[model samples]
Target chain A: MVTAKLLGLVFFTCSLEYFSLPHLAHRLFPAWSYLLSAIVLWFIPIPLLIWLPVISVIASSCFFTRRFNGGADSVMFWVGLLLALTYTTADSKTHFSVISVMTIGFVGAFAYFMAGVSKLLSPQWRTGETFQWSLSQTCFSETFPILRQHSRCLSLGILLWQLSFPLALTHRYLAIFYIVSGLVFHIVNARVLGLSRFTLAFSCFYPAILFLSHSGDH
Target chain B: MVIMAIKGLIFNKRTLPLDLLRLFFTSWSFFDRPGDSFRTRLTLYQDATPILEQNWPETVSFKWWQLIFNPAGNDWHYSKQLESCAAILSQKYPSEDFLQSREFKQYLNHILKYVGPKSFDTISVLLEVKKYSANADFQRLVFLTLPTTNKKTFI
Candidate 1:
C-alpha cells in the first residue's frame, strides 16, 4: 500500500511537469522578475516563514484573477490558484481551513465526474466489452500473456469501475474507493504496458483527495 | 608494428623538440577557426618559427570571442590552415618510414579528406571528427566546412 501511494505521488509529480504548471507559472510571472522575487523571498528570515504560504496564495490568486481575463488561460490560472490555496490551507490551523480542504476534495470529485460522464457519453466506453479489449491491448498485451485468458473478467471490472466512479463522488468512503481504483488502473497499466509516464500524468488528483481526507480526520 | 612506430617517433630523442612543436602546431591548427589571423599566420610558416612568434597565450577571453564572434568564418579559415599544416608536415617529413606506417597514412588521409573539397558533404564528418578527437576543442572546424557554393540555394 505504501508502494502504491508512493507510485501515485510519482505520477502526480510527472503530471505537474507535463500539464499546465510550466505555462501557468510563466504566464503568472515574468521570467527574470520571478527569479529575483523568489530569491528575495528565500532570504527573508524565520518569522516570515509562517506568513509566506498565505502571502504566496494571495499573490497567486490576485495574479491569476487579474491576468486570466476570461479564456482557457483564465480557467488554468484559477485552477492553479486553487491548487496553491489547497497547499497553503493544508498547512494552516484556521477554522475555515477545513472548508478550503473540502473544496479541494470537490476538485478531485469534479475530475471523476468529468471522466465518468465522458466515458458514458462515448459509445465505445459504454459497451464495457470494447473498454476491456482496448484496456487489454493498451495494458496487458505486451506482458503477462496469461492476462489474455482473463480478458472477459478484466473488461467487466474496468467498465464497472469507471461506471461507478461518478456515484463514488457522493460518499466519502466511495470517493476513497474510486481514488484507490484510479491509482490501481494507472499502476496496472504501467507495470503491464510500460505506460509509467502516462500513468504519472493522470495521478494529479491524488494530492487533493489525500489532503481532504487528512483534513477531514482532524 | 604501427604502435611501435608511433611510440618510437613520439619518443625519438632527436625529434622530441620538433614533435612537441609539431604537436603544438597541429593541435592549434586542428582546433583553429577559419579566417582567424592565427590561421593566416600558420600558412606563412615554413618551419615552426612563425607559429612560435604568433602564438598567443591561451586565455578564456580569446576563447569566448572565438566562440561568439565570427564563429562560422573562423571555422573555414582553420580547416584551410590545418590542411596547409598537414601538407607542410608531409613535405618536411617525407621519409618512407614515416609515410609507410598505415596508422600515420590513415591519420593523414583522415585529415586530408576532412580538409578536402568534400569537407562539407555531411554533418557526420563534423561528428566523426569530434568523436575521433575525443575533444570538443576541435569542434570549431565543423563550421569552416559549411559549403559556400550554394548559400543562395540554402537560404
Candidate 2:
C-alpha cells in the first residue's frame, strides 16, 4: 500500500489535465508552461512536489476566475493540500494517507449532499420535469432513449436517486442503496450526457465511503 | 477562539454560506424553466448558428477520451469560462459606468478568443434577466458591446 503511488496517480492525473488543453496555460504563461509543469510534478520530489499543489491552486483560480472551479477540482486541490502537509510533517499521529482518505469521504458525502440540496431547490426537480428534459437531451443507449419516451417513470426514478444520496449515512443497507444509486446515476451521466470525467473523479471516493459505511454502526 | 471569532464575523451577516452555496453547487439552481429563478446561459452564435447546434465533435470529442479518460481534465473547465464570462457581462454592464472596466474588457476579449474564430468580425453577448410572474413572462435582453464608443453594434 504505497501512499505516494496512489497520491501520485491522483496528483499526476489532475496536473497533466492542463497538457490536454494547453490553451488554458497559454493564456496565463507561455507555451513552455505545460512542459515545465510536467517536469516539476513528475521528476521533482517532496521538497518541490509541495509547490505543485500551490501552482495548481493558483493556476486553477486564475484560469477559472476564482469562483467557478467544480467539485472535482475542489476535491483534487484539497487532497493535494493534505498531501503537501503529509510531506512536511514528521509522520505523527496524522498520516497523509489517513487525511487524504478522510478528505475524499468528506468531500464525496458533501458533494452528494450539495447535489441533493441543489435538486431540492429547483421546482423543476420537485415536479420531475428536469429529469424528463435531461433524459430527452442526453445521447444515451437504446434503453435510455426509450426511457425518454416514457418520461414520467424516468423522471420519478431520477428524482428518487437525486434525493436519496443522503441515505448513505443512515444505515448499512441504505448506504449500499445510495452507493448503487450513485453508480447508476453516474453511469447515466456518462452514457447519456457524456459527462464521463465525473464518473472517474467521483468513483475515487466510493471505496473509502463504502469501507466507512461497512465499519460504521448499522 | 480565533476560529469562533472569524466564523462569527463571517456568519453574522450570513453572506458567506450563500456565496459558498453558489460557488460549490451546479448552476445555483438547476431550474432552467421560466420562473422567478436566475439562470445564466453562454449562448455562442457563429455565422448565425448556435455553437452547440453545430456539433463540436471535431472541436473537442464528446467521446470517453475527452470525457472520462482525461483524468487531469473535463468539460467543467470549459463551462466555468462561460459562467464567469456571463457573470462579468451582467445586465448592469450596458450602463455607461461600466464602459471603462478593464476586467470586463479582458473577460469579453477572452471569451471571444476562446469560443469563436479570430477572423470573425462581430462577437455578440446577450444577457437575459428573466423573471416570470403569474400574469406575465418578464424577460429583458441586454445586448453587451465592446468598450469602444464606435457605435458599431454587433447585436
Candidate 3:
C-alpha cells in the first residue's frame, strides 16, 4: 500500500512538472526559438499520451538551465528538485528506510524550531497578540474587512497560539489545538484572502497529512 | 526643523531599509538598559528641537546612497552609520536624556510597526549590530542595512 501510494505521488509530481515545463521554460529561457520549440513539444498531445520520458527530458532541461543561474531561480529549482526526488524515491525500501526518516525528522524539527525561535525573538509574538492580528490581516481581512478593526486583539490571539505550538509535540491536547488552529488559519486565508495556493500548498492538506502520518509511527 | 526632519527620517518609511533599521533597533533594545529606547530618543528630540535650533547646523546632510547601499563593500561601514545616526540624534536632544526612557520603547514599537517583519538572516544582522554597539544612537541606523544574501535565488 505504501509503495503504491509513493508511486502515485511520484507519478503525479512528475506529470505536473512535465505538463508545466513549457510554461516554466518560457520564463527561464528567453530565446524565441527555444521557447517556440518548447511550446510545440508541449502541444504534441498524442506523443505525451504515449510516452512520459519526453516530458522528463524537457522538464530536466528547463530545471538545469534555471538551477545554473545562481539566484532566486536556483533556490527554487533546487527545492523543486528535492521535492520531486523525494516523491519519486519514496517507495524504494533502501531510500525510504533510515535516510528518509532522518531527513523528514530533521525537516520537521527544524521547522518547529524556526517557528519557536521567531516567536521568542519578537516581543509582539511573545505576547501572543501579534498572531491574532496577523491572522486577521493576512487571513480574514479580505472576505471580512470588518475584522480589520479588531486586528490588535486578533494578532495577540495568534501570537499566543503560535507561542504554544512547540508544546504540541509533547502534549496530545496541545497538538490537537495546534492542528485545529492551523487548519482554521489556512481555511480563513483561503476563504478570506483568496490565497488558495498557499492554503493548499503549505497549510491545510499537506501539514495535516504530515501530522497524521507521523503521529502513529514516530 | 532640520532636527525634526532627521528624527522623522529615522522613524518613518515603509521600504526595506526602514524595516531593516527597525529590526536592528528592536534587537538592540532587548539587551539595552531599561531606560534607553527609540521612543525616548524621538520624544527627547521633539521636545529639545526648539532649544537646539541654533546648534542644528544648516549644512547637516548625509550621503543618502550610503543608507541604501554600503559603497565601502564592508558590512562594518553599515554598522558605523547606524551608530553615528543614533549618536547625532541623541546629541541634538541632549536635554531630555532620550537615551533612557519609556518613550524610547514606544519609538522602537512605532518603528517595528512601519518596518513590519523580517526573516532569520535579517534578524541576525540586527542582533549583530546591537552586540557591536552598546549605545542607542548607533543602533538606529540598523534599518538601513541591506540583505547580504544573493538575491537571484527565490527564497
Candidate 4:
C-alpha cells in the first residue's frame, strides 16, 4: 500500500508536469482530460480496480498521441498494471507480495543494466567526449567544474555502478547504499540537467528495492 | 533486451495496438550517443508571401522551483519530433515525392495544428542539423535551391 501510494504521488507530479504544457493535446481529446485524471489520481482515493483502468486509458492516449513524457512513464505504466494484478492476490490488502516486489526490483535493475550496457557500447560515452559535450550544452556547466575535469573517470564509475545495480538485491547494506547513491545521482541530474522527471520516476521503484533487500536479509 | 522489446513492440507500419504496446517498452538508451545540434523552423506562406515564422525548441529559462513542474521536457519531445521529420526528409527523396509522402503529410498535419490557429496557403518547415566530430570542423557543404532555379539561390 505504501509503495502504491508513493508511486501514485510520483505519477501525479509527472502528470502535472505533462499537462501543464501549453497547446500539447491528445489527437482525440483535449489536454484537460489529463489534468482531470491527475486530479482524480490525487484528490480521490479510488480503488485500484477503478484507478487502474482510468490511468491505462489515459496512458494509452498519451502513447498513441506520442505525448508520453519519458521512459519513466512506461515504467510507471508497467508498475501500475502489475500492481493492479497483485491487488487481486491474497495479503495484497496489506502489502505487495515478495514475488511482486522482487519483480519490480528486477525491472528497475534491468533498466539500469541496459542503460549501462548501451553507454558502454557508445564510443563517445566511453571516451567521455559525449559527456563533456552534453555538459557544455547545459546552462549549468559552470557549476560542476570538478565533474567536467573528471568526466571520463566519473563516466566510467557511473557505468560500473549501473551495471552492478542488480547486486543490490543480494544484500541490505548494498541495497541501501545503491538506493541512496542512486537518489543523489538522480537529484544532481535533475538539478543540473533539468531531468526532474527521472528523479521521481526512478524513485518510484526504490520501495521495491528496499523491500527486496529486506526480504533477502532473512 | 531493448532490441527484443523493440522487435516485439514496433512494426514497419504503426498501428494503435502496436503503439499501445510500444508505450510500455520505451527505449532505455539515455544519452547513448553524442549530443548534436538540431533546430526546426516553420514558415507560413500566403500566396507567394511569407507571413509568419516560428522556431521550435522555444526559449526556456530553468528555475530552481521548476524541478517540480518543468515543461521543458515536453518542449524537448516536440523538438525531437521535428528533428525526426527532418531526418526523414534528408534521405535525398525528390522534393515533390517527399512532400507527397504519407510520412511528411502526417507530420505536416500535426505541426500545422501545433503552430496554432493560423490559415496559410502553404507551410514549409526547415530543419537545421549540425553534427560535430572530434576535430570540430565543417565538412560536406551543400547548397539548397528551388526546383525552378535559374542561376538564382533561394537564400
True contacts recovered per prediction: 0.00, 0.15, 0.00, 0.38
Model 3 agreement with the true structure over A1-218: per-residue lDDT tens digits: 23222322323332333243331222222222223333332443232231232223233233222221112122222223333344456557665533433343334334434555565576664444454434332211133556555655665565455455555555456556665676676456445433322222222123323443456446
User: Candidate 3 lDDT, tens digit per residue, B1-155?
Assistant: 23432433443433435333332222211111112222112111222232111111111122322222211211122222233345445545652564443333333332232223322122111211232225434243222222322221111
**Can you give the lDDT of residue A154 in candidate 3?**
63
lDDT of 3 at A151: 57
- Give a tens-digit lDDT track for model 1, residues B1-155: 23433444443445455433432222111111112121111111222222122211111112222221221222233233344343344445654653454333333333333233421322211211122224343232211122222111220
Model 2 preserves the real interface contacts to a fraction of: 0.15
Superposed by TM-score, candidate 2 places the C-alpha of residue A54 at a distance from the truth, in angstroms, of 5.4
Per residue, candidate 4 scores C-alpha lDDT tens digits across B47-155 of 7688787775454566776564566644555546544564557556876776666555545444554555665666666666666644453222212212221122121
The superposed Cα distance between candidate 2 and the true structure at residue B134, in angstroms, equals 9.4
Docking class of 3: incorrect
Candidate 3 interface CA RMSD, Å: 20.9
Which of the two candidates, 1 or 4, achieves a greater DockQ against the reference? 4
Query: Which of 2 and 4 is ahead in lDDT?
Result: 4
For model 2, residues A64-143, the per-residue Cα lDDT tens digits are 33333344555545545554555556356656656555555566777666666777666776675666555433333224
lDDT, residue B142, candidate 3: 25
What is the Cα-based TM-score of model 2?
0.61
Top DockQ: which candidate number?
4
lDDT of 3 at B44: 14
Candidate 3 chain B worst ten-residue window by lDDT: B51-60
Off by over 4 Å in 4: A27-64, A91-96, A136-147, B1-14, B42-55, B101-124, B133-155
Name the lDDT of candidate 3.
0.33
List the candidate 3 regions with Cα displacement exceeding 4 Å: A1-102, A105-109, A124-146, A166-177, A192-194, A204-218, B1-155
